[model samples]
Target: MSQSDELAAQDAGDSGDGPIEELAELQVKEEARLEKLFAEQREERGLDDETTLHTFFKLFDMWIQLYRLNKCMEVLPEVVPICRSRGGDFHVKGVQALAFTLWKKSQFNDAVKLFHEIEDLIGCSAALCENMGHTYSSMGNFDKASEYFKRALQCLDKEEELGKKTGDRAGILLGLGLIEDRLGRFEQALASVRESQALFRQRANGKPSSLVAKAGMSIAKILLKLALQEPDDDKRQEMEDEAIIREEENVALFEVTCGEDSPLTASALRGLGEAQKRRGRVPEAIASFARSYQIEAQKDAFDLLGIMEVHNHLFGAHMDLVKLGNPLNRASFRNYLPTVDLALDRVRSMKQDANAGAYYKVAGEFAAFAEEYQRASKLLSEAVCLFKTEDDSKVEGLISHCEELKDFCDAQLSAVRGSATANVSESKS
Candidate 1:
């Protein structure tokens, strides 16, 4: 068989024999070699500890391929000390990898600190500055992020003048555009994002790309903000229509670039859904969010937080559908309530205690909106309990809101029960 056919056959097999298995076997052998290296006398074997340590550290990629990121990071501290002891480019490269790993793990502050250390060691490059920008942006320090993005752009400009390939130019502009948009610089944001989109499309050479799609989304979002600020109704409508079209195109691009069921596609769908929702396309929005939820739910590492956000969006869309006062929409709305409940319960089961109370509170409000008073009461009670135990003062406003919702639910339940009792008495008479 050809190599491709053999690989396909191995993938289709259920015998637990494949490239992954081969990688696993390799990892075991390499681990054994590392153990032997550690146990042997380096002087007698004429082996260098620095080289051995660096080689062992590079096994991080192997561990990552095996989906053992946490384990890889756990062992990083030990390897870091040896690299630092040796110093120079070797240590800088190792630290850079560790910093990126920390960023992937959502440890943004630590990643920023390491990126700074790299800068002190070898100065800043376009890649390092872009990474710093992303780290700061993730931490919600948009001003700092903008600074780094601008610095990265400057470095890329210098590289361009020297006839060097400035590959990350588009990404830096996109990041800067997003920061500017957040800071309410709509015109500047649009200019930067349009430039980024052009560069990305040039790089893609007419092929679909996630970066191109993302830049399109940024432009669409800016248009949305401008639409909100527009005083003329016709101009506002024109802007809104253009935004929706671009959003739809972005969704299509993401579907082609990253498979329909991929998380990236799912996220793009959510963005499209929000635009549709704003345009009063409630049903379309609901469909978009439902698809996103399905993709997130099916992932191996369940995105509980993503699922939670999807639930929030779905609940809001369904409620909007009910507001239309159509008999069919209203009838179908109750059916969605149980699905939301089940999904939120699944998230609650994940023990996201840090945000569990907030989740329950939001769920309770949605339940109350749907007139499911009893369910709302139960959820709000849970919220109160969870929040009370964990910094009640911090969530005083939330607690107050929950209490108000619970009281409203109680009154509605009482009225419902009383009306039922009166009806039964009348029947008996």
Candidate 2:
């Protein structure tokens, strides 16, 4: 059978197994098949041949479709010599693919450099601006991201005027909204996101597609934030209630569309947890956070920073329970220590000094509250070092505060050890 037919047959014969897992496995198999096919073609035609380059492009696209971005990174360098010699269009396509793959792989700096190269070659298009916007947003450069998103919107508008629809308007609006939200323009963010959500809904024929779910989630989160800023108690409560309902709907929608085990579902759950926590529903919040943690932690390419954030939430929720004098939650501290340790280890491995510093500081605060003074001091010291290395204006104050806290924790640890040693000596005497 042909490859397409074989894939169709496989999909048709899919049993009652996990749909997301099954789909992922299918993609992996397809990627492997393509790789093998490409190898055979390259061996026959050699790298510089037209047929081999065609196969190379096909393989690169396949890798992107399968989210096997690392594979794209591995092969791009090998094909660069041939692709550059072919033509401007060919080289542009290859470079664009590499940049996009790098962004997907979280190598933002390298991705930006390649993106600039693409712009230097062919000038800016809506798609190029959109990709750059996304990459900048990922790097936390909100102002630059906003500029790119606006540029993309302008390009889209020009295209629309020319009667050439690209169907990227909704996504661009959503991206702008996200950047505005980060920049604290909440009202603008809300309006943009709501408009984007409406567009997505219309595109989906009022159905729940992934785009609609994402836009809905963004709207819900903005509403939750607005609720926090509301002056009137009644209006705040109403907004909070609406946000919670929207979150719950999004969670259900994600479970149906992306599977319960999907990262989208986990993110929806985490948002729901945040909403619940805001409403002082500690136990419910804990359950939601725990479920989110479970799903995210199981993924092979899990977002370590996201997982750490979830762990922090879980720790906070558990600590809240203990603060309320819940005996059941007291032992939960012991259960959480290992998770905190694991998260900190992963953060250190990430080599993002600022992010690692923030995580360490948070972990240290939790450890200090748990009376694990020694661990707290160590964590705080690491944070101090990291913060000191950064060039932010606030870093010096943060470093001093962390150092002060670390001193307190060290003193507490020493006192505790001294008390224990004295008790042992008395018993021996």
Candidate 3:
């Protein structure tokens, strides 16, 4: 309705492109007007009162719900100082918002510093400590992250005694589970994840749809990881069976709460596929993978990285069937070739990791099976480079296997070279 805003809109309408700048300008004006209104209201109502403090907290929470990170970031810097100036219950949330913004921005060190400073000023809170835990975890400071997460759990327990919400306790457990899993502490990860799953189930209060499903998925994932590390066949099968049961629960819950087409259902299906594969139900595993891939393709097919993962799973399923001498249509995986190539190209552009090496090796092996020896040799060479970055004893077997496979591929090419040379020599003579 403002003159400048109307003019900007009119100019944007004249062009075919949408009015990004005009929309942003209008947003800024709206924010300014709201700020002025809130200031006026604060003047009449008094900022020191509980009601006004409640209003700011709600405002910040609304910003979070809307995912207005830039706006939230802008307001947080000013809001924290104002809260510190007056000092109230709002400071707790102000610190949370500021620290969360810093964490989201990937300014991990600054976020940690700000959280500690806020703790010194207004004392530590569960949410603030949780933010620091997440921040340090993301920054790869696992020890510090573990320390803060445990502290968060303790504070949350004390807060629960005051009749506050304990939903955050489940979140802390989930975080601990993830960290433990990454650290290769499978038992600890299972304990934490299982505890979180139990907590979520207990708190289900008629509408635990997402909460229960999430916790179940976490447990299922941990079980799968444990199964991967287990050398005993029977124990691994048992682990996989447990994981399948968990994933089936998640899938059923998602089917009721969401739909069959939901991404949660797709995720559950993918996990189910892996579990079934490990449990020696290859046919069921292949079916589950195909279903998962179909759902993912329909919903988010253009998500390159995600598609690559799905393709990898699908390819593995097919390869597993092939190994068992089952009649599987190998042509079904031909479509994945281009996607694998794309993933290889993209991964090559980034810093090498074990995951990158695995992808490369699998793609190379797939190519070799298809008798695309030149492509296989090229991809396998890239895989060799990435694998060299890993020195963990666990990966030595994988590295050796890769070298052996690469040599096989080279020999096949060499035989082709010899045959071609013989033909050329005969023709020249």
Q: Candidate 2 — what's its lDDT?
A: 0.71
Q: What would the TM-scores of all predictions be?
A: 0.68, 0.68, 0.53
Clashes of each: 0, 0, 0
Candidate 1, residues 1-429: lDDT per residue as tens digits? Answer: 000000111111111222222224455565557546544534343323665654454455444333344666666776676667779866875686677566655667887899899889978677677778877877889889888888887888887889974338777777777778778899998999899889878967776655677788777778888988999999988877887788788778766644566555566677778778877888888888877776665543345577678878987887776678744343444555665665675666677563787778877876777778899999899888888877766988888889998999999999999999999999999
| lDDT: worst 10-residue window of model 2 | 1-10
Regions more than 4 Å wrong, model 1: 1-94, 294-310, 327-354, 364-378, 390-429
| Backbone clashes in model 3 | 0
Q: After superposition, how far is residue 343 of candidate 2 from its true place, in Å?
A: 3.7
User: For model 3, where is the 10-residue window of minimal lDDT?
Assistant: 1-10
lDDT per model vs. reference? 0.69, 0.71, 0.66
**TM-score of model number 1:** 0.68
Taking the tens digit of each residue's C-alpha lDDT, what string does model 3 give over 287-308? Answer: 8877776665544212335545
Q: How does candidate 3 fare on TM-score?
A: 0.53
- The C-alpha stretches of model 3 lying farther than 4 A from their native spots are 1-123, 134-142, 176-192, 222-239, 251-270, 287-316, 341-361, 367-429
